[model samples]
Target: MQPVVVPEPDGSVRVAGRRVPRGELPSVVASADAGARWTWDDTNRWYPALLAAGVRVERAHDLRLAHRILRRSALASWPEPDAPPGPWDTLPPTPLTAARDEPAMLFPAPGPGDDALEPDPVAELAVQDAVVAGSAAPGRLRLLLAAESAGALAAVEMFHAGLPWLADVHDAVLTEILGPRPRPGERPARLDELAHRIRAALDAPASLNPDSPRDLLRAIERAGVGARSLRKWELERLDHPVIEPLLEYKSLYRLLTANGWAWLDAWVRDGRFRSEYVVGGVVTGRWASSGGGALQLPKSVRRAVVADPGWTFVVADAAQLEPRVLAAMAGDEVMAAAGRGPDGRGADMYAGIVASGAVPTRELAKVGMLGAMYGGTTGSSGQVLPRLAKAFPRSLAFVDEAARAGERGEIVTTHLGRSSPLPGATWHEAQSGAYQDDAGDDDVAKARSYARSWGRFTRNFVVQGTAAEWALCWLASIRRRLWALGVSSSALDAGAVPAPFAGRPHLVFFVHDEIVVHTPADLADAVAAEVEAAAAEAGRLLFGDFPVQFPLSVAVARTYADAK
Candidate 1:
């Protein structure tokens, strides 16, 4: 059964067209069957409130996320082809938190003719359901919508629960590296010393700040170092005393600015680092973070992520997700066989390629596979790609075919039926101009180059987008499995843990293919099994007997840094 939730003026919700009091919403949400999808106007607005109230819904059809998909997807047709977007298109995901770490104001100041509060959510959902049921590939589109909505729920839950953070540990690491956390508005003593050394090496006045690349570049040139830019790679080749301190300065400066003292004070609160997550933010269907640098955090600071006193983290990451996805997508038996480990558990795909004689070495095999999927036609990667094609012809040809179609400006769809955006007006004009009666050779060459560049994007898009879908399926399966593991009464109720996850094992962190679960100490082994089981379930759900394995590198440990 689907519950069409409409917000009522009385601060209650009309659930399934019946008035449900706001205070009683949790019980109503809890009574919803596991498979029932709660159709709402906007999940970012509705779900966060429910999570805060200790209610968690299993499935939902986020009208906002679903509308974006249907309105543009080549697979869906019920909303009418090329329909002009109205108020829906401009309505962005309500931010979970603003940049200042304060709760975001969900109710927006409406623009002229904007009646968002008065729209019939149930009617909109009916239209969406019809579009999916009448789609070119209903099953696939429906699956994609389900998975995307699941991701939306998970993202909000993660933000609300927050990642366990040890502030002292983070500060200690910073002090050890920077020689002490400097006073506010002052540089660390160690960084100041490095700045002095950089200035001395360049034989410049102390006024030339190393932090300013422009000043440092001119100073380095004046000192006869022949430096082009302050980029680390370009600086490393130069044999000069300045290179060492300058590079060190750059590194320390980055740490200081990106995740140093200010970051700690801002992001970490009440021992939980709550980074706002943006579901489906990336075009490839991968997640993107908003406030806090959770997704972009460096491994060095990972030690700060320590579990609670009586709990441990179960960290798991899928091995070579995109490559394995490509294998399953193309039905490449040789590639699929290589995806499994030598022990039949899991294998490094690059290593497996080497074992299959794709190239002379693992590194070459890795580059060759990347080049094929990424559309590299020259360089060392290009040189080794032919051998890889011979070893796994089906996988190579699959991406190559997508690239050709992209070159012709055709839309490419992901495995779960998410269609790629078509080329813009400029692209069509470029291609068309190249065919004009008096077109110049340079125009033709430029058009061809642009085509290859976009082709590369499409080639990688198909594989990456499909990999993202696999991750969604994987996480959704893990979520269901976790919910099945009822909260244990034996352990102390973890009050610091948020609603819905307080007394149970819950997901704390998620990257593209990696996840970390915070679980009670006694349940560590069980959680690990669940993680592996979910990986298998996700694989089966996507490819169903394709023989492609999304094996994980699993580790159970007290600190996140301890995970492999």
Candidate 2:
């Protein structure tokens, strides 16, 4: 029950603040003395500090958070091992550069007794705390959406700044917003509108010459103002006259690139629009796009994406993918087995992990196992995983290995060949030196650490990035298949495919880990099957061996929520 401490070679002991058996002390201490730092927990900001110290420390696979707390609290006074335990050191540190400071706890002070009060003072205190928290960062409520919006806005701002030609377009778009549509045959309604706006802006009559490149540029500039400030997600913004045309162009550009004019010609014949998606496009593995609004679909437009008469959409996903991957990686056999089906068989890989009683939730199963592997130091995985491991030793071993490697400053990699490199020599001297020493907090050392972290990032990138490639291939494959089917039929065949997604599925919508193909309802199920088969085929094509099993859950539905 006592805290773990390993004496470092430099005289100062690198304490784990975790439980250590007497027999293990000498080796652990020896490792610690060799400049090995304890990986307190996964969230420790001190990782860079450890790397800087020239410590080759590895995280203890079995350290718990509670034990870490006990150690930190005990070590809070430094060099003294008898101090009372504290909770702060067990948890991760708040980075100095973070936008907001941690909130303080609010509790009712000893006031009049609440036994006879109309309302409890404690409840009022809670409300005050909530308000304070909200006020501290009201934008946090929409931070995720806002982050994406910010990226798009940045792109637009950058484009506008770099492309002076766009100003004329913007001016034209503004003029069009205030002008009326023109009669057919005189000029297409869209061009006519643009002409009216350009004329008004110049204070004279002018018309858009469809054949002139300069005139086309003017027309585009006029039509683009609607989307200039896309952060306004309100319904009113959607109704703006300039908005639709700009979106249409953007969408058209994407379609044309993805399929070429040939595919677009065919899509027009069948009344179905296809969209392609890019998964794991964001650091968080959320979907993004090279082109098109793959993440954004208005319901009004969505309704128009019905499947052709005979097709149905078969949509599916791997249930609890990350959780299952964690369980498998952690070596939790019981959890892994629980991922099976009924009759004591593997049901869903994730659900089985839950059934194995390793953790109540799939996320916990993964996070907890990771916590354990990373020297959770203070019983961080809680009581669940340890107990589950009692019944599933095989499964837990993988996590133990990762933890050991991490503790040893060894980079762990995925199934692919991607490997992370060790930190440069500069980081070592800084840790051995004083906090104020020239070596300490050296910008070069800090920058090196950042680069080292990016190297570690590449370790995961191989697996996730390869997966993204497979998804893209699968999409392209199914898209081609669909096109071929349409071409063979008399009902569909015509126009040039759009860009970006040319020769690929018109990826109408995508979120991280999922895609929605806008195919005819009649062929939706068939397309879904094609997608599933292509995904599996993609795995084989890339890895040669299955490596890990790749399975997907598919569904047919009329609404996005239906997939859920």
Q: What are the models' TM-scores? A: 0.94, 0.38
lDDT of each: 0.84, 0.38
The worst-scoring run of ten residues by lDDT in candidate 1 lies at 99-108
Q: Which one wins on TM-score? A: 1
Candidate 1 residue spans exceeding 4 A from truth? 9-12, 20-24, 31-35, 98-119, 341-343, 436-438
**True lDDT of residue 437, candidate 2:** 41
Q: For candidate 2, write residues 495-561 as lDDT tens digits.
A: 2222222222233433444555544444555667776776656445444442334467777765444
